[model samples]
Target: MKLVIIDYGAGNIKSIQFAFNRLGYEAILSKNPEEIKTADKVIFPGVGEASSAMKMLKESGLDTLIPTLKQPVLGICLGMQLMCLHTEEGDTKGLGIFQTKVKRFSQNVKVPQMGWNVIKELKSDLFKGIKENEYMYLVHSYYAEHCDETIAATDYEINYASALQHENFYGTQFHPEKSGNEGAKILQNFLTL
Candidate 1:
């Protein structure tokens, strides 16, 4: 199957490419609008500042094209944050694929919530075979607030939506490609979807 990984100068991209490669799927990294339009599956992965990332996407015209994709699309980490309606970070506006908003984790808990975290109350095709409360790798300072689109929840100092799904669009606050075996399964499930 053809999987397109939208490249807009974000980090951790090669790792994701490697993850897909191990699964016998070589994800194409491109910024061409036409290539993205025809891909079977799309992965919008990013790690960086919100405004800058959005700027890159907009400059490449992906900022507009992404939200219009008809196939199953997944956004990881900052990619997920960008899909929200808005974000507190950099006072940036998002693609509005999900109605919720992204906000910085409360100071009560350490920022960047880096490392392994367990996610429970799983829902949607993204978690089809993954067990509940499964440990997944995460490295983010911002999170999506509670909303109807939340498919999985995680707790740091407070419970927050860790994964979200709406129609053809899906998002994960955690990096499934780096989340180990269960994470791989999630990516595989996304491919099948």
Candidate 2:
């Protein structure tokens, strides 16, 4: 399969590429529109500030291209946050693939809820072989709020959408590449889709 990982000067691209490699697929990282559009599957992985990321996507014309993707597209971490309607991180507007907004974690709890957290209320093929309450590695201060697109939910300081799906688009607030076996299974499910 022609798997393309959208590269827009974000962190964690290598780890995602390596994770796919471990699954026996050679995934390419590219910012070219044609390369991204023609891929059998696309992975949008990001780890950085939302405003800068959105700026990069807009500059590269990817902000317009990503929403029109026909094939399955997976957005990880900041990539997922960018798929929503808007984000509180930088008062940035998102692609709006999922009709939701990303908000900052409450101040009552430590910001950037990091480490393994259980994801439950699974509702999509993304969790086909994975059981409910499976732990996924997360590292972010902003999160997608619960919405109709939320397929999986998690709790930190408050209940939030851990994963979301809308049509062919899928997103994960956690870093599946760093989530180990369960994470690998989730990626495998996405690849099969």
Candidate 3:
């Protein structure tokens, strides 16, 4: 199957590509909408600030194109945050695929909750074979609020949506590419979808 990673100038793209490489699947990177539209699977990734990332998506018309994709699409990190209805970071509007909001963690917790965190209450085929409370790599300050779309939840200062799914769209606030074995399984599940 043709796999495409949207390279809209914002993401830990090389690492994601390498992750797929290790899975024995070649992932193509492109900013062209037509190429992305034709792919069997698409990955929307981001690693930088929110508003700026949204701007880049808008510039490429991906902001509009992403939500309409019929094939399975996975959004990672800021890409997942951007898939929500809105984000506290930069007061930016998102792709609105997840039907939730992204809020900043209070000062009571570490700013960027870095390192491995357990994700529980797993739902969706994306987590198939993945046990509950499995650890996944995470690094972020903003988080998606719990909502009907939330397929997996995690705790830092409080419980928050770690993974979301809506029809063909799937998103993970954690970086599966960086999360090791189980993470690879999640990506592999997405590939099967």
- What does the lDDT come to for candidate 2? 0.95
**Which digits, one per residue and each the tens of the lDDT, describe model 3 over residues 77-178?**
999999999999999999889899999999999889999999999999999999999999999999999999999999999899999999999999998999
User: Candidate 1: where are CA atoms >4 Å away?
Assistant: none
Misplaced by over 4 Å in model 3 are none
| Per-model TM-score versus the true fold | 0.98, 0.99, 0.99
Which scores better on TM-score, 1 or 2? Answer: 2
Roughly what TM-score does model 3 have, to 2 decimal places?
0.99
Can you give the lDDT of residue 1 in candidate 2? 96
Across 143-191, the per-residue lDDT of candidate 1 in tens digits comes to: 9998999999999988999999989999999998898889999999999
Taking the tens digit of each residue's C-alpha lDDT, what string does model 2 give over 64-142? 9999999999999999999999999989999999999999988898987989999999999999989999999999999
On TM-score, who's better, 1 or 3? 3
Give model 1's TM-score versus the native structure: 0.98
C-alpha-based local distance difference test score of model 3: 0.95
Model 2 TM-score relative to the real fold: 0.99
